[model samples]
Target: MDQLKYQMVIQWSDEDDCFLVALPDFPGSYWRTHGDTYDEAFANGKEALESLILAYESMGDNLPIPKVASSV
Candidate 1:
């Protein structure tokens, strides 16, 4: 959801030969999922985000605060 305000960054990786997705707001490494195409990568990223949110809620853990961009 837009309310979460999590950043999803998708980029092409030469080494992996696929599009890599990074959920910067989440913990762990930048790379979370990959896809042969850009769209697939995006879909995978969304799925990953949903799973993460559910996991946190089920554990009764506090979710990470979303970051906001400054106008300046």
Candidate 2:
């Protein structure tokens, strides 16, 4: 299987205790881990993405549905 790449944006959340991870291309697919630091959150997010990707692949499903960018 080809290596799949997905962007995981990690941002600090003041109201929340954990690091916020947002999958820009995948809506409603965000998760947070019990982390008090940025690095911890980033690490957790990476693990989360890896698991999600594996699950999808195991089910024979396509990962992110890349959109075709329109040129002006």
Candidate 3:
């Protein structure tokens, strides 16, 4: 089974006119999704994240575990 730890955060993106989803500690893990409303965007973001995780796991490479969030 795929085993990796991550968290999802969905926020509004005015510039994109879509939802901006991010994995706070997973750098470069983000996606822009469209939906009828904000709530749908959040839901879509979750699915997008799940798909990404699965794709990475299928690569047979070590899954990077997120430890903490940072700004540098």
Candidate 4:
């Protein structure tokens, strides 16, 4: 699957003292995963997104349309 088509939002949380990752296109929890560092959060987010796609496919559900950036 083309994972890049989806958007991944990563932000650092001072309360958690870690980086939080969110897959806005997947539709579920606001924050899907977290990591101690930015790189780790990115890797974890990618894995979570791939798993979500497979889960949706296995359940015979249509995947969400990826949002694209509009030209300014």
lDDT of 3 at 32: 40
Selected candidate, larger TM-score, 1 vs 4: 4
In candidate 4, the residue pairs with backbone N, CA or C atoms under 3 Å apart (3 or more residues apart, or in different chains) clash, namely none
**RMSD of each predicted structure:** 1.1, 3.6, 4.4, 1.2
Better of 1 and 3 by TM-score: 1
**Model 4 over residues 29-52: C-alpha lDDT tens digits?**
889999999999999999999999
Cα displacement (Å) at residue 17, model 2: 2.9
Per-residue alpha-carbon lDDT of candidate 3 for residues 1-72, written as tens digits (9 for 90 to 100):
335556667776788776666666444635545555778877786677676667777887555576755798
Model 2: number of backbone collisions: 0
What TM-score fits each model? 0.91, 0.69, 0.59, 0.93
Q: List candidate 4 stretches off by more than 4 Å.
A: none
lDDT against true structure, model 1: 0.91
Report backbone clashes per prediction: 0, 0, 0, 0
For model 1, the stretches where C-alpha displacement exceeds 4 angstroms are: none
Q: In model 1, how large is the Cα lDDT of residue 51?
A: 91
The segments of candidate 3 whose C-alpha lies over 4 angstroms from its true place after superposition are 1-5, 32-36, 67-72
lDDT of each: 0.91, 0.69, 0.65, 0.92
Comparing 3 with 4 on TM-score, the higher-scoring candidate is: 4
